[model samples]
Target: MALPPRQSCVDHEEISLGEIKIKTKDPACMCEVEVAPQHCSVDIKSVVIPIYLKFVDVRCSIRFKTSTLCRGSSNIVGKEILHGVSGAVGPGQILAMMGPSGSGKTTLLSLLAGRSQTNLHSGSITYNDMGYTKALKRRMGFVTQDDVLFMHLTVKETLRYAALLRLPKKLSRQEKIQRADSIILELGLDKCKDTIIGGPFERGVSGGERKRVCIGQEILIDPSIIFLDEPTSGLDSTTALRILQLLHGLAQAGRTVITTIHQPSSRLYHMFDNLLLLSNGHAIFFGRGQDALPYFSSIGLNASLLMNPADFLLDLANGNISDTSIPPELEIKLIQSKGDSKVGKPPELAVQEYLVECFSSEVAFRDSSVDSPPHAKDVILPPRREWSIGWWQQFLVLMSRGFKERRHEYLSWLRVFQVLVSAVVAGLVWLHSSADSEKHLQDQVGLIFFISIYWAYFPIFVAIYTFPQERAMIAKERASDMYRLSSYFMSRTLGDLPLNLVLPLVFLLITYFMAHLKLTVGAFLLTVLSLFLIVIAAEGLGLFIGAVMMDTKHATTLASILLLIFMLTGGFFTHGLASFVKWIKYVSYTFYAFRLLIKVQYSRSQVYDCLSATGCKSIASARVMADVDLNEAGPMEDVFALLLMVVGYRILAYVALKRMNTAR
Candidate 1:
């Protein structure tokens, strides 16, 4: 692609500032959502930002001491999404980052939120006292485009999860609940406190409601600074305005709220007290929103459209340099403005403070006279206590949702049902011929094939479905440091168990008896082992797919192809063929697993010892395997290898997941 052009500045005549007058209609209004451009205007004679230390406390200030490359600077030539853009936002103010859809607005938000810390080709970011990205991250909370919520959880549970995971134990339980409840009410989600924030499949609340819950979850953390990336992206204009209004309130209460928005409605356009305009990953304007037009006019860049100036800025940001020309005076204006040190507060605090002030202006809101702690009410609950509940708690939750999500569709269920039916058919076909040594081999092969199909295919299927859903939550939570990735992996793995165990175990047990595949107790135990291996391996497999492919359909496809390759290459299906593709058999997880488990079925080693010690017995009465031949190679070695395979692949899967890191 061609590069952004470096054009001469428009070199416009500077207008005298003595005639400029400030508008003052609504003194109470600042950057509130409802504030109009006409309601509040600053005098042109002085800087809107005066150097203030308090501003340093609330806004994470990013500054480049040297002059920055503007929209068409000759020194700037790269495809970087976010250029050396510097701006500031403090407590109780709104700094709406306005740019086109892809002008690195979200990218800049991500950086400010400390979600990602890749060093800029140049610049410095300071949050509170910390200069590095790491320190800034700890004090900041970020909300992304995707709301990472557990659909199975109620609003209360979701908030509770975040609280427990985020806040240190020093905080009292009451405080956490109060904190959570406050966020719920603050976000205007009190009415849906018990509702589930559902997804496309799990119908519950509206998209806007779910989006609010996401913001609420982050709010519960009560960070010193909160950064939201496109906080109002997907909602309707009214809903979006309401959400922004809620954020404005949050800012007024001494919280810092920095968010990115694109082509906002005219009403939303004027809501920003401070605007950071970016084009081509470069800053064009970084000051009051209304000043945008004058900045353009000063640059001699034409912007006659009645639409939001953000749109005009965005077009200039993403458009071809050849078609666009930067006015000379605009560059000088941007360069001059770059030196202003103080940035304003987050607008969220203003709204929040306004509400607090409105309600408590007359009464002592903080005094005990306002309201005492309410008395606790008795309630009957489940007999099972929370302490004793182990992974089983998660297991039940995951299993219930998995079944509900999968069971409703004929298309989904058919895949599961077909496997079960195939198992039954195989059992009936192989049952009558499996007492002799050759028959024993056939029986072993039957079990291996059936088990391989289940283990190989099921994990891929689950991975395909579960990864996309989990990714949203994982990425969001990971960015927040809600929990360690290992913790999440453990919980999710444990949670999916009860459901995963049932299918493979049920099919194998029923089929085993019907096929009469060496009914030794040892074989039965191995059957359980086989199930465990498959399920765990399958989980690992699914994780690999999910981590590598963000798109579920693509992940599913990749997983399926991998499964086919591994299963076909498994020695059980075509043992002699392995000479040509022997490496394949070695790598095939199913091959090793099924071979190991099937050997146990065929050998009945434990049963053989018992029978031999008794000097054997009549075949009919003893029901011992006649082919417990000493000449046969034992399945013990194969079984151990399979067990190792499970461990090996599981570790590999975890490594893949870690490598496919999230924004953090």
Candidate 2:
């Protein structure tokens, strides 16, 4: 057999397959030849192998500490989440996990998918009999219950971005787009591929379509194993059935699929080849789905003629059969007999223990074809896979997506209207003031100070919500090894710059000429630049608050407090503070921005007339600067200070976000 043609080491170079050597005279073409039996062989054509993941005696337990502070004393306790639950999922098979609400179904799934790291995990999870590691994680996909998608993006755009971030770099841009299109068609989202995935305020695709788009995103990598948590929770019966059918097709095409389902219909239940039933974190049944009915029957439990098998199992697991429509006398006898078997034990507890014992005796032995424990030498853990794209590519893709999302979600015409209205109101309040009158000077000072406060307050409030909203999405993507944290942070910061600049600039343009304080082109441009910088600084501060706090309401409150502090020390409300508290003014961005605006407007002007009757004397711009305490720092120095604050706050925000994601 002959191997497929490989890329030449150089133009017109000869390659020998048997010898695993390439002959080339060009020193630049120093490519080395390597052969592997599964991918490429010197004597045979390319061979492909499918991956199947299996776990044996897998157990996970989470220890959480709860503290109560009463009378200045603390108490703590710990608990386990999952017991020794074990099962296997192979190629072309679907494993459906069914359990009551708090039975650790999602916890077990998280353990298998490596999504939770703050747990005590034991036993073995293997891919093709090799130990599971980061390399294998790259080939597996996990879909969360909630659809954490960019709500502003179309289905096609979302999948395309996923492809760009996840697909191998060897694939060209066009190839990646084609892959995304294929997945869109496969998931039946072609009908709404171009529609936005709307959120609470926007009306876009249906719930079913959004769920399909979520699945389609994970499918871009062509993963060998896919795990989903409650994929059918919100959809109607028909849509639920369709999603299961889609998973069935994927399994048929040689992918292992697993999902946790709640109260699935009988038709949907039968689609699963295997079922792992749990109660109180104990695996009660782990075998073929068809075997569940017969196993229960052998244990003296029979399903009603028309009862759905799923409902029967769920009722049996939950110990709720006595609450059903059985006859009163029969129900009493059933309850009496169940109580007699276990005296003081709860029915659910008794049933769980009995089922676990039976499953161990009957099913474990039959499935123990593999040895009880394999030697360390027998378990081959693959090396971690390299990232699909480099950092530059990741940054570009993230920045582009951020820009598009912000344009659709945040930068609306309504925001423009609000800014215009505020600008017009400010203009009307201080319309056409002159430099000669003392009252005009006071109004001009008030206007500049208000401008600083308004830009600072508005941008900070808006930007504070960014991290709280996207933290889940960021955590998910990071777990999948999609991109670097720095790339995402930089992209988001840069993406917001356009809107931040535009909104503040518009406000300045409307109010700058309307107030008639600074007539020179130089002064007007300087004022606009100063306002833009202040807005950017405020936005950076907001990002820091959002990232550090990670809760919208709490972050908002903290941001309001901090902004209040900055506003008080902003050189307008108070000219001098106690010596001990004067340092706060130095730290406040608003103080610097306000001083810069004041200096830009008055530093070069000479007062020709005075309207105040007390003194009534002409004064230079120097006297005006001394009156406002803007002489401490030059305009350039204040500008530099604001720039430093922006950079410093953004870096802190990035660090906080990185810590939060890794803390789990």
Candidate 3:
């Protein structure tokens, strides 16, 4: 069976920027699709539609400051990485950046995408004659090589959250889902739409499908210009080709797509409409992809028949080309030796200088214009509006996602069993101690300190992994203008509260009755409330540590050291120290929690036979409080301190996250 050739449903006609008029050859067969001035689409058939996108012409000469050790002196010297390298990527075209490592491919893409925070010595990046502002950045998307996704989320759920955060707030929930569905179909991910985006331990979609889902995420925003850094990295050859084909299709649909690729296949090399070849941060070639062969041939470096053009070009760029008369093995050795010799300059440096000179005389350079098209004058881009949803809405969405992620990650059966076992062990150790016995006072105090330590230590250690694990995702989403950092931080802090409180509540429930300290309802409730506050304070401390360190190992080590210091000074291991050092207990939340637990359990009680061997005596709870050096600090005062610590640490965490993100 043969498939029918697709026919155009509408007559081709040129439309101006503000006005679009479509004339159909057959009215009955055509689907009438209205177009908006801000964005327009012409439906060729029910299945194929091309967007009338605003063409973006990007031209920039970017540089960054770097420090190098001085040769003779101990001082550092500053240098520039990029040296005014410039090029343009026009609309409906795929501009592929190819070069060796450290060739500034990713740096150039970051600069063009307006995501770099490094110093720009001099450059101007404009879209359709307008300056590249925050407005334009929101309309563009940059997909990093590494896919940062919520592994617990399904493909559809992932796209839905992306749409909810990135799409205009005016869109209804159903509309956003529909948009996500459309993108899923376009990316050919409909089959795996229901599958979870699994991680190292879980089985789910293939690598190719995951990459497509990443692309689908960006496409949900309907960006006019898209930048991808090594989208084919870590994929098989067949998968890489399929990904390139998808990018090519997007370009054909009127998107200005730019990507950095390394060592592409021959078939993949031909897919690019334009090529930006670079060497040592210098432009070797920037023109049509087809012109590369002729350009190289004219320079007496013609590629052999059936040779991969990309490899040959890279070889030429890297100064590894050999004459036909020279043996290939000897030529490689000679090139290696030349690179090793450090007398005058490396072979690559000489090659870069030669290419830089040759590029000045290339026909592409002589004929190419870095100016915007004339039609850009009449084109009216829509006024830029906020791309994020409302604050409360962002909170709700992030809260939902956080809950789902924690449910899968932190609330496992192993975690539950560990908590239960620890609680049972603590209960057995301090099984039904009397509050009025002076001999049992130490045991009761130990039990209270252990309970405080359990609540404080585990939550802090568990939360140490929170920010580091999500740091990449936070950077990606923040770069995409998805939501405010405050909303995300607040929602995550609030959302995890329930789960954080659950284990502590369970531990207290088992220990409270088994130890049999206080039977009054008010006392039990106060104890529970105080323990909850302590857990929150511990969580905040963990968040602060994670945010400042941004590395799991470093944060965990620092947190362990800090927690150990707090535990030592928590009024359990030591009774009295120098006044100068005794103030350390004031800073430890464990001190307050332990003191409050003791006061709540033994307040208004009395202990008989306090004397060791001289005489019998009766001791009041107030005297016991004075003996512990907590007479001045009541239960309410400790509670207040714990509450303050919670708010203070969370605020500090927020500040740290903002600073780190800004620095990045």
> Per-residue CA lDDT of candidate 2, range 264-362, in tens?
998998899999988777777877889898877776567655688999888877866553343344345557657685575665555566666667776
lDDT of 3 by residue, 455-535 (tens): 889889888888888888988988887888888999999999888778888888998889887788998988888888888
Predicted candidate 1 versus true structure: per-residue lDDT over 1-664, tens digit per residue = 1112213112231222222111212233121122234332222211121111111111122333343557543343334565456666666668888766666777667665656545443454444323433433334567887676666667876776566565544456566677777778777788888877666777777778888887887666444467788878888999888888878876766567788887688778877777876654556566677877675555455655465566666665554223334555444434444544364433322322322232233221121211211110111122321221234433343344445443333134665587688778877776644544433445545555776677767666765556576676667766665556565565555556666666677677767788776667887887787767666676777776676676888987787787788878765555456366667767766766665554565543322222344563222222222212322567666566666765665566567678766734
Give each model a TM-score: 0.66, 0.87, 0.85
Error of 1 at 37 (Å): 41
Query: C-alpha displacement of 367 in model 2, angstroms?
Result: 5.3
Instruction: Select the stronger candidate by TM-score from 2 and 3.
Output: 2
lDDT for position 608 in model 2: 41
Q: How far is candidate 1 from the true structure (C-alpha RMSD, Å)?
A: 17.5
In terms of lDDT, the best-performing candidate is 2
List all candidate RMSDs to the true structure: 17.5, 6.6, 6.4
Ranking by lDDT: 2, 3, 1
Ranking by TM-score: 2, 3, 1
The TM-score that candidate 2 achieves is 0.87
lDDT of each: 0.57, 0.76, 0.74
| lDDT, candidate 1, at 77 | 36
